[model samples]
Target: MENDQQQKLISELVFLIEKGNAHVSMEDAVAGLPANMRTVIPENLPYSIWQLIEHIRIAQKDILDFCVSEDHEKLAWPDDYWTEPVEHIDDQTWENALNEIKQERQRFFDLLQDEKTDLFSPIEWGDGQTILCEAMLIADHNAYHTAEIVVIRRMLGCWR
Candidate 1:
């Protein structure tokens, strides 16, 4: 049985993970970006907006899978997490990335909402990390990269 405080914490964390109170939500950050503009790398920016989106999707999926899967293999850092910058961004690929993020977000939300999930229990395979910690990490990481996407859009003069 969750106490009032535990329930409140769960609720707050879910809201933060999904809604982005202090920064732009992931949905808004990527919304309405034209396929032509998705691959444009702003001057001095290392990653195109498309690369950032794919990176976010990969990283988020890794964290979520780690939280749930007992036999999950970790992805190689920087390499597996990022895609090479491409000259063209296909509309189907862009939509799939967006859909992947939403699906992963929903999975994390479901885990948090599960009454039987022990938020404080450390994963045996991980280094003393709890579900609560992973949830916070996902929220923070997503918020940071989502903001980067927004900045890229602004730099391209596409964000409205």
Candidate 2:
């Protein structure tokens, strides 16, 4: 790909992952949420805000590892991705998980920014996956969960 095109693609991907161009960013969706409300499961919903954030963290980290490491172990679907149902979380734990998500996401942005990282080449250890594919997966997955978080907030009468 041309250098200009590659740079443009990287910029767009970064925006897609971090800015949530089409919807609320993950951070914004969770911002101002009451500590008590974080663990409250809305009626008919299968998860709480805490669970959703943890799921985003785990899945983002897993995809980051897969993109950056050859020996990355695949996590079991639905089981390893979602956290154990939790009814409570301390401030420190909540902050830590949120920080981890930011850190993992920054790492992915770094990978995208690296001029030597080939976005379109198939990953050697995988069947036929590319960094581009993984990037889209991360963005799409996070956006979907972020929307769910917003919906839960609305259902709980907490959304502005």
| Colliding pairs, model 2 | none
Cα lDDT of all candidates, in order?
Answer: 0.89, 0.93
lDDT of 1 by residue, 1-160 (tens): 4488888998899889888789988888878887789899889989998898898889989998999998887899879999998999778878888898889989988988788788998987899999999999998998999899999999999998
Q: lDDT tens string, model 2, 1-160?
A: 8999999998999999998798989999999999999999888888899999999999999999999898888899989998877879999999999999999999999999998899999988877999999999999999999999999999999999
Error of 1 at 22 (Å): 1.0
Off by over 4 Å in 1: none
Judged by lDDT against the true structure, how good is candidate 1? Answer: 0.89
| Candidate 2, lDDT over the whole model | 0.93
- In candidate 1, residue 130 scores what lDDT? 93
